[model samples]
Target: MHHEAVGRDLSRKVHAAEAAVDHALIEIAALTAALPEARMRAGVSGVTGQSAFDDLAASLSDMTRARARLGGAHRTLAALARRMGLGAVAAGPMDKPDDQPPLDGSGGVTANMVNEM
Candidate 1:
C-alpha cells in the first residue's frame, strides 16, 4: 500500500510539471516571434557603442540564457520526482528530452525574449 501511494505521488508531480512546461512554451514562443533576427545577428560594431539598440541586444542576450537555465532546472526537478519510487514514471524507451532550451542567450535584452534563447 505504501509503495502504491508513493507511485501515485510521483505520477502527480510529473504530470503537473509537464503541464507547467507546456504553458511556459507558449509564452516562450510569443517572445521569440517578437525578436528581430536580422538585428540580433548583425549586433553592434565599435567600442563603447552605447546606443538604445545596443542596450536592447544586451538585454535579449541575457534573457535567452535565463530561459535555458530555467529549462534545465525544471528537468532536474522532474527527474528527481520521477526517481523517488521505482516505476514512478513509466519503464520504457527514454524517448523524452532532457528539457534543453532551443535558443541561446546573449545577456538579457528585456524581460521577454525567446528567439535568442
Candidate 2:
C-alpha cells in the first residue's frame, strides 16, 4: 500500500512537472514573439535604439535561463518517477534503434550508415 501511494505521488509530481514545462515552453514562445513585436514597435516609435535592443536581448537571455530551469525540473521529476518505478511511464516511448552498432572509428557514424540501416 505504501508503494502504491508513493507511485501515485510520483505520478502526480511527474504530471505537474510536465505541465510546468509545457507552460514554460508556451511562455517562452509567447515572449519570443512579443519581443520582436515590441522591438519593432519601439523602432517605429523611434524610442527603441541601442538601449531597447539591449533590453530585448536581456529578456531573451532570461527566457533561455527559465527554459533551462524548466528542463532541470523535468529531470528531477523523471528521477523521482524512476525511484518509484514509474520512469518509463513518464518518459513515454523509446524508439531508439536497437541494432545500431557502436561507432568503430574516430570519423563518427556517417549519414550513409544511418540511411542504410
Candidate 3:
C-alpha cells in the first residue's frame, strides 16, 4: 500500500512534468512560427538591423533547445508512467469512457481520470 502511494505520487509528478513539456512545446512552436514573419516585416520596413535579426535567431535557437528539453521530459514521464503500470495514460487522447475505469468513491483516483483532469 505504501508502495502504491509512492507510485501514485511519482506518477502525478510525471504527468505534471509531461504536461508542462507539452505546453512548452506548443508555445515554442508558436514563437518559432511568428519570429520569421516578424523578422521579415521588420526588414521590409527598415526598422530592424542585422543585429536584431541575429538576436531573434538566437532567441529562436534557445526556444529550439527548450523544445528538445521538453521532449526529453515527456519521454522521461512516459517511461515512469509505464513503470507504474499507467502507461496507457500517455498512449493517446482519452476520447471514450471505456478506455478508463469508473470511480469507486474510495478517495483513490485512477491514472486515466487524473490525466483527464
Evaluated against the true structure, the overall lDDT of model 3 is 0.57
For 79-99, candidate 2 gives per-residue lDDT tens digits of: 554455443343222223543
Q: List where candidate 3 sits over 4 angstroms from the true fold.
A: 44-117
Model 2 residue 110 lDDT? Answer: 30
lDDT of each: 0.47, 0.54, 0.57
Best by lDDT: 3
Q: Local error of candidate 3 at 93, Å?
A: 7.8
Looking at candidate 1, the ten consecutive residues that score lowest on lDDT are 108-117
Q: Single out the weakest 10-residue window by summed lDDT for candidate 3.
A: 95-104
Candidate with maximal TM-score: 3
Q: In candidate 2, where is summed lDDT lowest over 10 consecutive residues?
A: 87-96
Choose 1 or 2, whichever is better by lDDT.
2
TM-score for every candidate vs. truth? Answer: 0.35, 0.42, 0.43
lDDT of candidate 1? Answer: 0.47
